[model samples]
Target: MKIWGYLSALTVAILFGVWFSLDKTLLGYLHPIVLASATYLIASCFLFIINFSPLKKKILKIINSKSKVEDFITKKEYGILFLTAIFGSVIAPAIYLNGLNRITAVNAALLANVEILFIILIGVFFLKEHVKRKDIVGFVFLLIGAIFLSTNNLQNIHFDASLFGSILVIVSCFFWSMDTSLSKFLSHKSNIIYITALKCAIGGLILLLISISLGLSFSLPLDKLPLLLFIGLVCLSISLPLIYFAIRIIGSTRTGSIFALSSLFGAITAFLVLGEPLTVTQLSFGVLMIIGVYILYMGDNDQNV
Candidate 1:
């Protein structure tokens, strides 16, 4: 079961990497906000169907019966959860997808490593979680690697599409870091299914409204409907639920490390699928990012034992 959990985490990362690649392709036809809203809406429906199924009834009952205070959840708990969805799911993806349109997938993936640093800062200062000295060193290496990859196109920065894209990706990382920590707290009381469903549903609905208010065209690309549905089902619905379950079993530190692996997967997918060039800077930084995550994972295990 534990091995399954680790595999699931890795699988989620790989699936997300695929999603990022495909999503970039799809962006030519659909707006980022529309894509994100549609993906999450489909995911919500999928989760709701399973939650209402007979097989899930017993689990649902146990989750509902768990008292918030006793389980470290309260009315305030739901508030934080909802905000996490708003920022992390709704806002973050919208920004990221739009940003990816302007950036190479490899750079986007490398820049995402910034989330680890944000997570560490949040854990130590805001959440009051302990951070080992080794973790700081690991983060420093990761940051340096990310910086190297980001500046590879320094001479072309003005001509490159990645300038604004990188900023959006960093913002997305902040929201994601917050979401990860908050979800860790909420998972103690709520069924992973319940929390995931609620987040997607609420977040999707909010994005839908925002899309409408902004007068963003929601016209479906008739020819691309199949691709859209495939993304919605496999990437959004299946990957997210399994990700939550992985978080439950592995703890957030390990989960974060595994999640970071998505960058590697993204880089490879981008090279193959998007015909993007892979540069030496990207290669060097990618290895550094992976090593940094491995160190974090190792540190987490040592502390746990």
Candidate 2:
């Protein structure tokens, strides 16, 4: 991968970390569905504006022939892309926000890393991607770290700590993993900006309807306006576009692994912002997780060699 690509991917991960922490703060003031709807709406608008710009039009034309665009983007493609939007942008954020409300931001952040494991599993089994023995070993370390992170009150496991929220996050992860894989396949045939915009617009519309039906409030205080905009621009607009670029540049498996670092950043941010307590176990597990990630990455390098 290019150095710029890796840096961009890392940047996305860090922004995602900050986004999760800020999302918790935002959730205190707004419903997750409403927040998601607004963010996606903002993202969609941004994508639409960019897609229609002369610069992007030229780039899009160069990347895809007009005939290819028409042929590649069938109803089947739209259907798949819409489902991707539903799972990734709509359901995932809703679950994550709900879980964030129920648990500490640190715990929620760490648990969200489970998506890496899910992605790897889906890639290996369903997608028929190669998986080395070391990858499996790395996954074990990640699982161990997750256990340490999840055990907030070691003496008392909180099963009631948003089981529904957790399930939603997991399902969201599954959808996102599938989306990532599908995006990679689709990129060969179509413009990524078009695919991304479609997902955001369709997904945002769905969530908007749900938010309205659920009677979620959309009111925002003047003081909270800046944070909401920051979240919308930085987290939703910037980070998501970067994620798409990262997926295109690095491929999903590597992107997924690198993205796993978001958990570590989230943990540190939670400690600083939320004053969440950090135990020795969590710290040690974090180190192990990093080492495992390094090992897995090295294995990937070896295969390429």
Q: Name the 10 consecutive residues with the lowest summed lDDT in model 1.
A: 62-71
lDDT for 239 in candidate 1 is 77
lDDT of 2 at 160: 59
For candidate 1, write residues 1-305 as lDDT tens digits: 45666887899888877778778778887789988998889888888887778856675454345333233457888898888898778888998888888888878877777776777777678867777778877888888776666656355456356566777877888888777766666655546676678889998899899888888877876887887888877887777766666666666656666778888888888899888888887877888888887776573653431
What is the TM-score (0 to 1) of candidate 2?
A: 0.86
RMSD from true fold, candidate 1: 3.4
**Which prediction has the highest lDDT against the true structure?**
1
**TM-score of each candidate structure, all chains considered together:** 0.88, 0.86
lDDT tens digits, residues 1-305, model 2?
Answer: 45555786799789878888777777878898888888888877887787788767675564444223333577777777777787787877777777677777766666667777777788778877787888889889877766655564254356655554555555666666776666655544446666677778887888899989988898878898788878776677767656656665667777777777887888788889878876676667767776677777783752221
> Candidate 1 overall Cα lDDT vs. reference?
0.75
